[model samples]
Target: MPDDARDLDAEVRYAASPDVAWVEGPDRVALVDLRDPASATPQLCPEPAASLWRAVAEGPKGESQLVALANDVVGEQAEALVAAFLEALAGAGLVVAT
Candidate 1:
Protein backbone atom coordinates (compact mmCIF):
# COMPACT_ATOMS: atom_id res chain seq x y z
CA MET A 1 0.00 0.00 0.00
CA PRO A 2 1.25 3.51 -0.70
CA ASP A 3 1.64 5.89 2.21
CA ASP A 4 0.92 8.87 0.00
CA ALA A 5 -1.81 9.20 -2.57
CA ARG A 6 0.60 10.95 -4.92
CA ASP A 7 2.78 7.87 -4.77
CA LEU A 8 0.18 6.52 -7.10
CA ASP A 9 0.60 8.17 -10.44
CA ALA A 10 -2.68 9.57 -11.68
CA GLU A 11 -1.61 9.35 -15.31
CA VAL A 12 -1.77 5.60 -15.40
CA ARG A 13 -4.28 3.99 -17.66
CA TYR A 14 -6.02 0.70 -17.22
CA ALA A 15 -4.80 -1.40 -20.06
CA ALA A 16 -7.46 -3.93 -20.83
CA SER A 17 -4.90 -5.17 -23.27
CA PRO A 18 -5.45 -7.33 -26.33
CA ASP A 19 -4.47 -10.35 -24.31
CA VAL A 20 -7.57 -9.86 -22.17
CA ALA A 21 -11.14 -10.24 -23.19
CA TRP A 22 -14.25 -8.74 -21.63
CA VAL A 23 -17.33 -10.85 -21.09
CA GLU A 24 -20.69 -9.57 -19.97
CA GLY A 25 -23.21 -12.20 -19.03
CA PRO A 26 -26.65 -11.57 -17.57
CA ASP A 27 -25.32 -11.61 -14.04
CA ARG A 28 -21.75 -10.50 -14.40
CA VAL A 29 -18.99 -8.61 -16.22
CA ALA A 30 -15.59 -10.26 -16.14
CA LEU A 31 -12.17 -9.73 -17.72
CA VAL A 32 -10.40 -12.80 -18.90
CA ASP A 33 -6.62 -12.36 -18.99
CA LEU A 34 -5.22 -15.79 -19.54
CA ARG A 35 -1.45 -15.99 -19.67
CA ASP A 36 -1.82 -19.58 -20.71
CA PRO A 37 -5.07 -21.32 -21.53
CA ALA A 38 -4.00 -24.41 -19.62
CA SER A 39 -2.36 -22.76 -16.63
CA ALA A 40 -3.22 -19.19 -15.59
CA THR A 41 -6.63 -18.48 -14.14
CA PRO A 42 -8.94 -15.71 -15.35
CA GLN A 43 -9.76 -12.77 -13.09
CA LEU A 44 -13.25 -11.51 -12.36
CA CYS A 45 -14.02 -7.85 -11.72
CA PRO A 46 -17.27 -7.46 -9.86
CA GLU A 47 -19.34 -4.36 -9.01
CA PRO A 48 -17.13 -1.34 -8.34
CA ALA A 49 -14.12 -3.05 -9.83
CA ALA A 50 -16.13 -3.62 -12.96
CA SER A 51 -17.22 -0.01 -12.83
CA LEU A 52 -13.66 1.12 -12.36
CA TRP A 53 -12.60 -0.91 -15.37
CA ARG A 54 -15.18 0.87 -17.45
CA ALA A 55 -14.00 4.26 -16.25
CA VAL A 56 -10.36 3.56 -17.01
CA ALA A 57 -11.37 2.36 -20.41
CA GLU A 58 -12.25 5.96 -21.17
CA GLY A 59 -8.60 6.95 -20.88
CA PRO A 60 -5.59 7.29 -18.58
CA LYS A 61 -6.39 9.15 -15.37
CA GLY A 62 -4.92 9.95 -11.99
CA GLU A 63 -6.04 8.57 -8.65
CA SER A 64 -7.71 11.84 -7.66
CA GLN A 65 -9.55 11.99 -10.93
CA LEU A 66 -10.77 8.45 -10.52
CA VAL A 67 -11.91 9.18 -6.98
CA ALA A 68 -13.76 12.23 -8.15
CA LEU A 69 -15.47 10.25 -10.89
CA ALA A 70 -16.40 7.50 -8.45
CA ASN A 71 -17.50 9.89 -5.71
CA ASP A 72 -21.18 9.14 -6.11
CA VAL A 73 -20.55 5.43 -5.97
CA VAL A 74 -18.20 5.57 -2.98
CA GLY A 75 -18.92 8.77 -1.07
CA GLU A 76 -16.32 10.29 1.29
CA GLN A 77 -13.98 7.34 1.11
CA ALA A 78 -13.53 7.81 -2.61
CA GLU A 79 -9.79 8.29 -2.48
CA ALA A 80 -9.09 5.15 -0.56
CA LEU A 81 -11.57 3.23 -2.59
CA VAL A 82 -10.10 4.30 -5.91
CA ALA A 83 -6.55 3.60 -4.78
CA ALA A 84 -7.41 0.14 -3.57
CA PHE A 85 -9.31 -0.60 -6.74
CA LEU A 86 -6.35 0.42 -8.88
CA GLU A 87 -3.97 -1.52 -6.66
CA ALA A 88 -5.98 -4.69 -7.00
CA LEU A 89 -6.22 -4.32 -10.77
CA ALA A 90 -2.51 -3.67 -11.04
CA GLY A 91 -1.70 -6.58 -8.76
CA ALA A 92 -3.73 -8.85 -10.97
CA GLY A 93 -1.63 -7.65 -13.94
CA LEU A 94 -4.86 -6.38 -15.44
CA VAL A 95 -3.61 -2.77 -15.51
CA VAL A 96 -0.28 -1.07 -15.89
CA ALA A 97 0.69 2.19 -14.17
CA THR A 98 3.21 4.31 -16.01
Candidate 2:
Protein backbone atom coordinates (compact mmCIF):
# COMPACT_ATOMS: atom_id res chain seq x y z
CA MET A 1 0.00 0.00 0.00
CA PRO A 2 1.04 3.57 -0.59
CA ASP A 3 1.63 6.07 2.21
CA ASP A 4 -1.77 7.77 1.91
CA ALA A 5 -3.58 4.52 1.26
CA ARG A 6 -2.94 3.67 4.89
CA ASP A 7 -5.46 6.23 6.10
CA LEU A 8 -8.24 6.00 3.57
CA ASP A 9 -11.89 5.56 4.67
CA ALA A 10 -13.60 4.48 1.44
CA GLU A 11 -12.75 1.49 -0.73
CA VAL A 12 -10.32 2.03 -3.58
CA ARG A 13 -9.54 0.11 -6.76
CA TYR A 14 -6.87 0.81 -9.38
CA ALA A 15 -7.64 1.14 -13.08
CA ALA A 16 -5.39 0.57 -16.12
CA SER A 17 -5.38 4.18 -17.29
CA PRO A 18 -7.21 7.49 -17.15
CA ASP A 19 -8.67 7.27 -20.64
CA VAL A 20 -10.85 4.34 -19.62
CA ALA A 21 -12.42 6.32 -16.83
CA TRP A 22 -16.16 6.34 -16.42
CA VAL A 23 -18.40 6.86 -13.42
CA GLU A 24 -19.96 3.71 -12.06
CA GLY A 25 -21.62 4.13 -8.70
CA PRO A 26 -18.70 3.84 -6.24
CA ASP A 27 -16.11 2.96 -8.84
CA ARG A 28 -14.43 4.41 -11.94
CA VAL A 29 -12.32 3.25 -14.89
CA ALA A 30 -9.34 4.88 -16.62
CA LEU A 31 -7.69 4.71 -20.06
CA VAL A 32 -4.12 5.28 -21.26
CA ASP A 33 -4.67 7.52 -24.29
CA LEU A 34 -6.63 10.70 -24.60
CA ARG A 35 -9.44 10.84 -27.11
CA ASP A 36 -8.90 13.00 -30.17
CA PRO A 37 -10.51 16.38 -29.65
CA ALA A 38 -10.98 17.10 -33.36
CA SER A 39 -13.20 14.09 -33.84
CA ALA A 40 -16.86 14.90 -34.29
CA THR A 41 -17.87 12.61 -31.47
CA PRO A 42 -17.55 12.09 -27.75
CA GLN A 43 -14.00 12.47 -26.54
CA LEU A 44 -12.19 11.60 -23.35
CA CYS A 45 -9.88 14.06 -21.62
CA PRO A 46 -6.30 13.27 -20.67
CA GLU A 47 -4.69 13.29 -17.28
CA PRO A 48 -4.74 14.87 -14.85
CA ALA A 49 -8.35 15.56 -15.85
CA ALA A 50 -8.94 11.90 -16.56
CA SER A 51 -7.25 10.97 -13.31
CA LEU A 52 -9.41 13.38 -11.37
CA TRP A 53 -12.52 12.08 -13.07
CA ARG A 54 -11.47 8.59 -12.10
CA ALA A 55 -11.27 9.60 -8.49
CA VAL A 56 -14.72 11.14 -8.50
CA ALA A 57 -16.22 8.26 -10.44
CA GLU A 58 -14.69 5.85 -7.97
CA GLY A 59 -16.02 7.74 -4.94
CA PRO A 60 -14.10 9.13 -1.98
CA LYS A 61 -10.94 7.15 -1.38
CA GLY A 62 -10.39 9.35 1.64
CA GLU A 63 -9.34 12.91 0.91
CA SER A 64 -5.80 12.14 2.00
CA GLN A 65 -5.42 9.20 -0.36
CA LEU A 66 -6.82 11.26 -3.20
CA VAL A 67 -4.43 14.06 -2.39
CA ALA A 68 -1.53 11.66 -2.53
CA LEU A 69 -2.64 10.04 -5.76
CA ALA A 70 -3.23 13.40 -7.34
CA ASN A 71 0.21 14.52 -6.31
CA ASP A 72 1.74 11.43 -7.82
CA VAL A 73 -0.29 11.13 -11.03
CA VAL A 74 -1.12 14.78 -11.58
CA GLY A 75 1.21 17.07 -9.59
CA GLU A 76 2.23 17.92 -6.08
CA GLN A 77 0.18 21.13 -6.16
CA ALA A 78 -2.77 19.45 -7.86
CA GLU A 79 -4.29 17.79 -4.82
CA ALA A 80 -6.68 20.65 -4.13
CA LEU A 81 -7.24 21.17 -7.82
CA VAL A 82 -8.27 17.56 -8.28
CA ALA A 83 -10.59 17.77 -5.29
CA ALA A 84 -12.26 20.76 -6.84
CA PHE A 85 -12.42 18.95 -10.15
CA LEU A 86 -14.19 16.06 -8.52
CA GLU A 87 -16.66 18.51 -7.00
CA ALA A 88 -17.37 19.95 -10.42
CA LEU A 89 -17.83 16.51 -11.93
CA ALA A 90 -20.24 15.64 -9.15
CA GLY A 91 -22.14 18.85 -9.79
CA ALA A 92 -22.37 18.09 -13.51
CA GLY A 93 -23.91 14.66 -12.80
CA LEU A 94 -20.82 13.03 -14.20
CA VAL A 95 -19.84 11.46 -10.89
CA VAL A 96 -21.70 10.15 -7.87
CA ALA A 97 -20.46 8.77 -4.56
CA THR A 98 -21.87 5.48 -3.36
Candidate 3:
Protein backbone atom coordinates (compact mmCIF):
# COMPACT_ATOMS: atom_id res chain seq x y z
CA MET A 1 0.00 0.00 0.00
CA PRO A 2 1.10 3.53 -0.67
CA ASP A 3 1.26 6.28 1.94
CA ASP A 4 -1.93 7.70 0.49
CA ALA A 5 -3.74 4.43 1.11
CA ARG A 6 -3.22 4.88 4.84
CA ASP A 7 -4.83 8.30 4.60
CA LEU A 8 -8.09 7.01 3.10
CA ASP A 9 -11.20 7.76 5.09
CA ALA A 10 -14.92 8.25 4.56
CA GLU A 11 -14.29 11.82 3.44
CA VAL A 12 -11.37 11.06 1.15
CA ARG A 13 -12.35 11.62 -2.45
CA TYR A 14 -10.99 9.69 -5.45
CA ALA A 15 -10.99 9.99 -9.21
CA ALA A 16 -9.63 7.96 -12.08
CA SER A 17 -6.08 8.70 -13.09
CA PRO A 18 -5.83 10.84 -16.22
CA ASP A 19 -3.16 8.52 -17.61
CA VAL A 20 -5.45 5.53 -17.68
CA ALA A 21 -7.24 4.38 -20.82
CA TRP A 22 -10.22 2.17 -20.19
CA VAL A 23 -12.72 0.16 -22.17
CA GLU A 24 -15.95 -0.95 -20.56
CA GLY A 25 -17.28 -4.30 -21.60
CA PRO A 26 -20.60 -5.92 -20.82
CA ASP A 27 -19.14 -8.07 -18.06
CA ARG A 28 -15.89 -6.36 -17.20
CA VAL A 29 -13.68 -3.31 -17.77
CA ALA A 30 -10.12 -3.20 -19.11
CA LEU A 31 -7.54 -0.58 -18.21
CA VAL A 32 -4.14 0.46 -19.46
CA ASP A 33 -1.75 2.91 -17.89
CA LEU A 34 -0.58 5.14 -20.68
CA ARG A 35 2.27 6.49 -18.63
CA ASP A 36 4.03 3.13 -18.63
CA PRO A 37 4.33 1.93 -22.20
CA ALA A 38 6.33 -1.15 -21.25
CA SER A 39 3.59 -2.35 -18.93
CA ALA A 40 0.60 -0.85 -20.67
CA THR A 41 -1.15 -4.15 -21.04
CA PRO A 42 -4.88 -4.04 -20.51
CA GLN A 43 -5.91 -5.21 -17.04
CA LEU A 44 -9.33 -6.76 -16.56
CA CYS A 45 -11.44 -5.35 -13.73
CA PRO A 46 -14.24 -7.65 -12.73
CA GLU A 47 -17.48 -7.21 -10.82
CA PRO A 48 -17.55 -4.54 -8.14
CA ALA A 49 -14.17 -3.28 -9.26
CA ALA A 50 -15.59 -2.60 -12.69
CA SER A 51 -18.63 -0.88 -11.24
CA LEU A 52 -16.55 1.17 -8.88
CA TRP A 53 -14.14 2.04 -11.67
CA ARG A 54 -16.98 3.34 -13.81
CA ALA A 55 -18.32 5.37 -10.96
CA VAL A 56 -14.99 6.99 -10.14
CA ALA A 57 -14.30 7.58 -13.80
CA GLU A 58 -17.37 9.77 -13.99
CA GLY A 59 -16.21 12.07 -11.16
CA PRO A 60 -14.49 12.22 -7.82
CA LYS A 61 -16.27 10.37 -5.01
CA GLY A 62 -15.71 10.05 -1.29
CA GLU A 63 -15.20 6.67 0.41
CA SER A 64 -18.76 6.81 1.75
CA GLN A 65 -20.23 7.13 -1.72
CA LEU A 66 -18.21 4.19 -2.97
CA VAL A 67 -19.24 2.06 -0.02
CA ALA A 68 -22.87 2.87 -0.71
CA LEU A 69 -22.47 1.92 -4.32
CA ALA A 70 -20.83 -1.35 -3.31
CA ASN A 71 -23.27 -2.19 -0.54
CA ASP A 72 -25.65 -4.12 -2.74
CA VAL A 73 -22.84 -6.32 -3.90
CA VAL A 74 -20.88 -6.93 -0.72
CA GLY A 75 -23.38 -6.32 2.06
CA GLU A 76 -21.68 -5.89 5.45
CA GLN A 77 -18.27 -6.01 3.81
CA ALA A 78 -18.87 -2.92 1.69
CA GLU A 79 -16.72 -0.60 3.75
CA ALA A 80 -13.74 -2.95 3.88
CA LEU A 81 -14.18 -3.87 0.24
CA VAL A 82 -14.27 -0.27 -0.86
CA ALA A 83 -11.29 0.58 1.28
CA ALA A 84 -9.29 -2.33 -0.12
CA PHE A 85 -10.34 -1.42 -3.64
CA LEU A 86 -9.31 2.17 -3.16
CA GLU A 87 -5.98 1.11 -1.73
CA ALA A 88 -5.31 -1.22 -4.63
CA LEU A 89 -6.42 1.35 -7.15
CA ALA A 90 -4.22 3.97 -5.60
CA GLY A 91 -1.25 1.62 -5.49
CA ALA A 92 -1.80 0.61 -9.09
CA GLY A 93 -1.93 4.21 -10.22
CA LEU A 94 -5.43 3.69 -11.53
CA VAL A 95 -7.07 6.13 -9.12
CA VAL A 96 -5.88 9.21 -7.25
CA ALA A 97 -7.10 11.02 -4.18
CA THR A 98 -8.38 14.48 -4.83
Candidate maximizing TM-score: 3
lDDT of 2 by residue, 1-98 (tens): 88545545344432223333343232333322334434423335455666666654455455565677778865767767656756655454344444
Indicate whether candidate 1 or candidate 2 has the larger TM-score. Answer: 1
Which is the better candidate, 1 or 3, if ranked by lDDT? 3
> Model 3: clashing residue pairs?
none
Model 1 off-target regions past 4 Å? Answer: 1-10, 25-28
Alpha-carbon error at 28 in model 2, in Å?
A: 14
lDDT of each: 0.68, 0.51, 0.87
Top candidate by lDDT:
3
Error of 3 at 53 (Å): 0.5
Clash pairs for candidate 1? 10-62
> Per-residue lDDT tens digits of candidate 3, residues 43-65?
88888778899999999988878
